[model samples]
Target: MPSRSFVVLAEQAQARHDGRVQFRQVLIDAVKPAVDLVYPPRCPLCGTAIAQQKGLCAPCWSELIIPGEPCCTTCQRPFPADYSEAAMVCGPCMADPPRHDGIAAGTLYNHASRALVLSFKHGRRIALSRMLAPLIIAQLPQLEGEWLVVPVPLHWSRLWYRGFNQAALLAEHIAKATGQTLLVDGLRRTRRTQPLGGLGRKGRERMLSGSIRLHPRKSDVMKAAQVILVDDVLTSGATSDACVKALKRGGAKTVKIACFSRVLDEARGQNTAMPETKTPEA
Candidate 1:
């Protein structure tokens, strides 16, 4: 019914409307609410809906104690308020120094931190590693000369049942982030020990003692190599100490630990870190 000229004008108006607005961007923005409705990013620590993935909401972050400066020179534990600023080994560590040269953890293990660690360690939430690896790496000082990133090894039998090693996953992400060479198999668990959860320090140590060793064929390469041990949690330092002992016995020059969380007997109310020589960072 319209004249050709009128028809042309109508088409032009439609084109102008389409061009004036970015339908792609508009559509993307419009669907975001729907998209968010279907899939929202939740905090890794708690299920609270957060703005982004791998987020620890403000409350959770505040509740969890992050390790910072003036840590122990040996064990890297935070000092009690009265003893802050003095860098010395806690009595517990001084009683018998850990075999590893040094140790550090991203956060003190507590009720607030336990949930996050358990969820990742047992809940099969591999995605949480993205958030956790950074925390572990943050505590590590740069090591001397081309250190090898070694994840605490899991016995093959346990690995078969679990389908994955949490420590190896952390080591993988850490190796990528730091561009360090990783030897996931540099150390192998000689035998499976009982889970360390219900064990005291001595029990744990006894269980893990003589349980780790370097790969027989890889021994030549690892000899004299500095080692960076990776693990999910540091409880009594027994397993780490055992690992360090094995490595040193196998000819590793030095070994240090970088773990995501630590379970210390803070109720004792004493200094927590240990004394050790500072390694020059490369």
Candidate 2:
């Protein structure tokens, strides 16, 4: 018979095979029940009870507007359902392309998405950043590449009034979830402009021109770096244009705008038409 001491030692050695025991899983097993008991997981979109974890309720999920192809390859502008594939560039972009390399956006800036952005932006629903960040991340094809995750900065005045920069929050979450290095204060809004909501394209661009610049301290890192620019909404594309110009001027090799929502420019509606070689979904 084996000695009791040796048998006991063998048992301890077997138990000490730590690879067989997952510490994270053990912690989750012990803690999740208590956390769930006290605070249930509610739907991020509607705050209703959900059968599953980490997403919107079915109705809310269905309401999200995801624009597919047959859109502008450059600006990702949405065209009518009958638009053809041959016509990818919008009139504005074709006439004079944007200064930035390209754009990627999560969804159309319809009523549902607008409400979400407003809730997160002005209503202090900061938790929505985690929920909405995946939308922007989905649009990034170079997410895993060597890149800087940069957020459009809010001016100090606006930051004081808003209490937080929504773009930075989104960028942080994107970095956390994707393991990307985030440049939290990469861009600084040097000059504040009036709200650009109602401004025409030219007016918005003019207002934002020379308004943003690369952080002096971060200039070295930005040199020749591919950048993923995060923002809450792509409105007139003027702010993005200015920021991209600044990024390139600061020596960023490539700048791609990624936003949770993109405003479909109505001015380009007629100009986005293509020949009948490829048709959009009606």
Candidate 3:
């Protein structure tokens, strides 16, 4: 059991965090008009000017595949309109059940979404976090129990090189929007692993094995709690699975994955050619 002092201290920390977030929002709101005027909004993909900031043009918007219902019950991979079943589990889920509760993906991996991800992540367009976070939030279900938002951790080397973890940015926005507790350091990457690009599911799993674990101080906070593991992209599911395993190992009751995009090669079938990992953003 946690002590009263611990609870109070936690509350204070959360209050401070909320205050900082609100301050940033206020600051952005204040200067956004001027910024918009200086650099008019344009479609992230095609560079076509748009009316609103952080929005897509009509053609680019059409290219994005926002996932909806008739999805796999276990994984939430969208199913075809004519696809129907009593269990509602996709073929992949049926063959090998997922360890996590389900996935909440904003869009299927497509050219338009790929460009946005590359721009936001690799191109250092941090402002795009605002645009991407909402897509992921729209896919999330209403919460019924206590839920903690946690980002998939990055190793020290990666953090130092990248300056910021893209997943953490998304997770922070999600926690703020959903009114959930954001445990920014809930999980920690134990060591640096090679990128998962060009790797098969088994190969990726092998690389991520024992690479992620719950933060020592976060065990109590995670115990019996429902956790939302956030990431920018869900490719092979290897990374998210490792994070979920760590959360459950730390006594979390349930873990769900929320991501900006998901690569559904199985759902899309052999006809659709997809990139192996797509910038190692998984």
Candidate 4:
């Protein structure tokens, strides 16, 4: 029913649009090599020059401790000796089961991972999400069904001060990487609590007892849903435990804690106290 002249004009416009898009891409391709020559990519962590961008140097990469199988089924901590069984829970977990399903950590807390955490959190290196999210993803177990990616919420006060939630940033990347739905406001902080550093497990528990809860609007979606609760670091297991409890109360079928770094008791020489690195309140 349309006129032939109108059809021809529309086709011409589309061809022009496609040509512009191709020209823009060609320009970008041409400029990228010049930009790389002027400013070569370097290691994000150690500042050592590297062949590619957003990659770590060999020495810095080696310093990171990536935990693998032969780990506790509940906490995912590597066992002391090689065990034949496919699944094994540690003695501590056997004695008292954890509320959350399990923990998947990118790396064990160490000097190298510590620097990454510090820069991502306090230094506001938001771009690091692209580099850091993959580490957590590599450690994540194969998720069966649809899983919701939820970041541990930041208090309004802290969120306002920092201008961004590092966990949420990581969750955004994780959701995209895994093709999972992201619920940025799945959880909410009830109030701002004191810095949880230097606190014992019991002390941290008390401080965070009612500090986190499910966002009211997301309660329906959370019901019986699988969730990946994200955080930058896992220390003392107190904050993460609290978040898990909140998700469980919201009827989340299984809530797995995924983090960039995990502070392990064995890594701490079995000391109960946390290390000197700064720990942000959950």
Error of 1 at 16 (Å): 40
Candidate 4's displacement at residue 129, Å, is 1.1
TM-score of each: 0.79, 0.77, 0.85, 0.85
Write model 4 residue lDDT over 40-84, tens digit each, in one string: 987768888888657689999999899887899889988866586
lDDT of 3 by residue, 199-242 (tens): 77899899999999999998888889999999988988999999
Please list the residue runs of candidate 2 whose C-alpha ends up more than 4 Å from where it truly belongs after superposition: 1-41, 44-47, 79-87, 143-145, 267-282
Cα lDDT tens digits, model 1, 78-190, are 77656765657777679877788887688887666677767776677888888889988888887657888999998898787767888999999988898889899988998
Q: Which model is ahead, 1 or 4, in terms of lDDT?
A: 4
lDDT (C-alpha) at residue 42 in model 1: 80
Identify the runs in model 4 with alpha carbons over 4 angstroms from their true place.
1-31, 34-39, 269-282
Residues 68-170 of candidate 2 have per-residue lDDT tens digits of: 7777878877777798768478887899888877778888766567667767776787988888899887877655468888999988988887789889999
Better of 1 and 3 by TM-score: 3
Model 3 stretches astray by more than 4 angstroms: 1-33, 84-86, 267-282
Global local distance difference test of model 2: 0.79
For all candidates, the clash counts are 3, 1, 0, 0
User: CA lDDT of 134 in candidate 4?
Assistant: 97
